[model samples]
Target: MADSKERLASSLLELKKYQEQNNTGVVRGSSTLGRTHLQRLVENGWLEPVMKGWYIPSSPEDVGTTSVWYANYWNFIVEYCNSRYGDDWSLTAEESLTIHSGNMVVPTQIVIRSTKATNNVVELKYGHSLLEISTSPASEVAFDPIYGIRLYGIAEALMFSSPNYFKSDPVNARANLASLENSAQIIRLASVNGNSSRVGRIIGALKNIGRDNIADEVLKFMQRLGYDIRVEDPFDNIVKVSASQSPYVSRIRLLWEKMRGQILSMNLNLSRIDLKDKDSVLRSMETNYVKDAYHSLSIEGYRVTESLIERVRSGAWNPDAEDTDRRNALAARGYYQAFMRLQKSMATCLEGDKFDLESELNEWHYELFDPCVQAGIISPADLIGYRTMQVYIKGSKHTPLPVNAVNSSIGALCEMIEEEKDGFIKAVLGHFFFVYIHPYMDGNGRTARFLMNMLLCSSGYSWIVVPVERRNEYMQSL
Candidate 1:
């Protein structure tokens, strides 16, 4: 019995070694030993039965299974592909992007290209499917050293990917692209000849990068090769080239010109305010808050007063109270609450030595909610009710800018401000971009005024608040 137990333990160790070497659990050993040995291991909780004749080594941590088990599903596919096709497996363009970006936002249907004719969709655990489409693999498609899988060329990747995915938002797309470490790889792929049409589309698709020259070069090359082209520049209206054109190249050329201008006009600069002395800056921020809030509220036609703030904080106004005065009082209270929320959020964010404006804004939302609820400005029921109303009424509309998005957007704006040599453009665009993002749900106008004052203060310019009389012009400029 001791020798038999030793033999079983040896077999389990061998199975674990095999799985680790292959990065997969499926292993075919001697048939007689395999079935019985696997069953014993399963009974002993030393292995998990994934499928008939397929088992994975299990530990105490594997007791509560989750969707993360599906991650190993890719390893299974890789092993199966290698066994069947022998080192000829590759992911499709979209799948490659999903893997490259480490984005687990899995799509229901994953498109793949292969020399073999396969129409069958292999269903994965948790309703994911890998749809293998038949196509000739590009010559440039090669194994990524880091990921250990075949990847599509950048040009082919951009071209084959759905345009809607890239067009979700220019700012986010640009940020993602900029975050990529190997942008030159894409540029190299774009330089290829057969992919000119796709290259043109990608150039037009890129919202944030200054790639007009590259697009022009691509256009000229394609035109010389007798390919009809038209560009669709979606970034701005100033480029004079209309999307309406007969040939594709004509539209593409116009778009390229316009995109070039927009990209060039974009500011990319570091913030002027020194983040090192955060304490002193925060003290100054509190001082500026009083002045800015007063002016901002005055411009918004609110008779803002210290007494009004105190009343709001002390629960004199009930957001849900049926009385008309209660409603008015709540509105007044909301104004002060919003300002204080912004101030508190800013203070928390600036409290630490490091700058994390986004985190500060996110924290502010949770922190502000309790105070407003406690003060009777908003009931607990109103929170859910308002959120539901917002979803139905503004479902198709854009989300009102939250503080985190605003702060991140501001970080981008500050990048632009520092890069542009001209001070006038910096000042105007700085204010324009901040308000354009509309960070807060109700206090955007006030916040925009506050941001503008911050910029003005930094630049030695007088902090100018738009008067209530000039609200129309102020909004129009924004």
Candidate 2:
């Protein structure tokens, strides 16, 4: 008879083969032999039970991990959907938009669509839930071959989703729509009409492009059918007209006016200070630098003090000191380390041929954390955890970006900053984008502030620190 170890090894090999093929529903028998095998697999940390009778391959990293439930979620959902629904399962329009935006901030309740009825809210482990809603008769769905699932078209997606989804914080909603990098998708959305009343509202919500004509045409067609269409353009402060008032005409007209206003007000000029002389420029630069440092630290959730600033200025700051001043010392050291790294990054950028901002920023990040990582002040694992902890707040919803995407977004942002000519705009955008990307496991806000100062320094501007009092405004600006 085979020993327990031999049996365990055999069970592991079978499980691995199943996982490799992306098969999740294959049942191991419920006999004594099967129960023993599964128990051994779980005990040995080779498998994790996702739900009843379902198992996922587990790595050493997966044991006792609570933070990255979304990663595990994506894995389980992909497996579960494939096993149960095959190609019949699909994400809702809003979920599709979230995916299309390269946003990994998983929704609290993932909305999906299927031919079969499911519970409106299905709770998952780790405080996440999935809401599966049936698509309306007027809704249109299309197959996304990439994921082998059907999803609502952009036009259908906008129309079918709640108006509250677009109306909350109109600026961000408009920004998200405007920043859509895919032109073909936009055109496709513009071409579809009469699918949903929400399409008219979506057209009104879009910021850039002269697609009002298309929307107008669609609205005219919808109005001919006597649908009670009301366009909700949140960006405009116009009078709310009744739907009885030419709904199509009023909505499209207001959207066009708003679009024109946005186009006219799109300021590309970088803010500049009037310096009387080189000395004045130098003084202003210093002031801005200090301001930037203070604000950056404040935003990063630090309580800055004069002593900490002094230590940072002096170069004798230490994070591992065990005195009463340790916290302050650590803050000071972290600030200085970030500052020096920024200096080195800027210098490297100045010397480089390709103007590679992303590469330089990444190099700076490594340099900034090297000392802490080496001295055991913070471990490599913690550093990784810090980067993964970045959360993006959309209205009241907080979405955490996956670790892998954070790195990519950071690199992309650096490339964008390198292309910008306006120093103030560069600084502001860099700071916003860095925090938005949340690249590192931790220290992202500090790193971002350092980046802001570096950009300001390059252009002969002062460091601008945000005070703790203005934290709300700081986050709002971002």
Q: For each candidate, how many residue pairs have backbone atoms clashing (under 3 Å)?
A: 17, 18
For candidate 1, what is the TM-score? 0.45
Give the range of the ten consecutive residues with the poorest summed lDDT in model 2. Answer: 241-250
Model 1 lDDT at residue 404 = 26
Cα RMSD (Å) between model 1 and the true structure? 16.8
Please give the RMSD to the true structure for each candidate, in Å. Answer: 16.8, 10.5
Q: What's model 2's TM-score?
A: 0.53
Instruction: Report the lDDT tens digits of candidate 2 across residue range 188-237.
Output: 55445444446556656542233444446555656666655565564444
Error of 2 at 111 (Å): 2.8
Candidate 2's C-alpha runs over 4 A off are 1-12, 23-37, 60-62, 134-150, 169-176, 179-196, 207-359, 362-432, 435-453, 456-478
Cα lDDT tens digits, model 1, 72-141, are: 4444555545555555557776556544332323355555567773767766545556677767554566
